[model samples]
Target: MVRRWKRVMAFLIAIIFCINCVMNIGVKGTYAENSNKDSNTEEVHTSAEEKEDTTEIEKETTSKAEKNKSDGDLSVDKNEKTTNKTEDDESKTKAVNNTILDWDTYKSKTTLVTVDDTNKRIYVKTGEALTLLSNCSAENYKDYIISLDSSVTGGAIEIPFTYDGYEFKGLGTKECPFEGNFNIANIKIQSTLFAGLL
Candidate 1:
């Protein structure tokens, strides 16, 4: 009876030891699996953070480039504006310098002659007749006579004819001749002369 009780106790102790060993192995395996999962999660989180940082850096670089481009465009626009103003000023100066006549003088000296009036065509028996001609369609003719304020010397009078709308003017004496085809549209004929009439 004593030997049988000892064997039964020994068997019970061995079964308990095996159960404890299996429980310890299971706990170790579960701890290892949890540790591996934690490491993988940390790696994934680190990669995500790197990507976000790269994205932010790229955005900043793009913004800076855009700002620089806009500044360059503004400079170009300013230069163009300056160039335009300079051109306008030059044009105005040219116009002023090339002004044909003083308006007050032009109004005083200019005269119109109509084609129908025989009196409009000045017939000078003493000096060469200065004839004004035009190819443009006729409108009205006002006599523009700038006769000598005083008689010229040597039995010859130099009569000045200032016509407003003539394309050509003739000035000639029996001794010497002078004629000009002028662009009447551009020139303000301030003064001209007729000499040596029949």
Candidate 2:
């Protein structure tokens, strides 16, 4: 029975190998055929009239959206400044707390939001990493610890102004929630949470 089982397993392996070889050959042939066609093909061109029509349609859509904003169909700040943006505008121009915004402006700050597994550039306040680093810290010291790793040079405690609303991972205590929507550039809590702001 053992010999029969071995023979069957070997037969299955051989069958799988043959199938894989045939599939590889077929795929290679298909790829070669497509490449040959692409090399010989000429670029398609849109007529001048067609281009003009497309432009006009796009312009019309844009104008309609503008008209809606003017008519108050879209949310617009009544106190919005014409030029020379205020400091508040610069920092608060993003999703706040739990409020969501679809604008690319928020996503543009690649460091703030968790995007594509590129780890957040979170840092501790110079000397806070001594107690906790990897996992969450004590409930009481949750607000104190942000990160243990000190990637910054010169012991610079000031987080950048561009890092508005940046949330720190493995921060906050059991008593206090993790710091979210925090302006690391302008840290207020000094000794209580951050040691210095690295």
For each predicted model, how many residue pairs clash, with residues at least 3 apart or on different chains?
A: 10, 5
Tens digit of per-residue lDDT, candidate 1, span 115-196: 2234333222222222232211112222233232223324443323322322223344333332322112222233443232
Clash pairs, model 2 backbone: 125-197, 139-174, 142-172, 142-173, 157-197
TM-score for all predictions?
A: 0.32, 0.22
Top candidate (lDDT): 1
Off by over 4 Å in 2: 42-198
Tens-place lDDT digits, model 2, residues 1-198 = 999999999999999999999999999999988877665552223455567889999999999988987877333454454233665654554434223223244334333322221343334443222112212232333333234233444434533322334233333444455543333443332234432232
The candidate maximizing TM-score is 1
Score residue 139 of candidate 2 by CA lDDT. Answer: 37
Residue 198 lDDT in model 1? Answer: 32
Worst 10 residues of 2 by lDDT: 127-136
Error of 1 at 122 (Å): 57
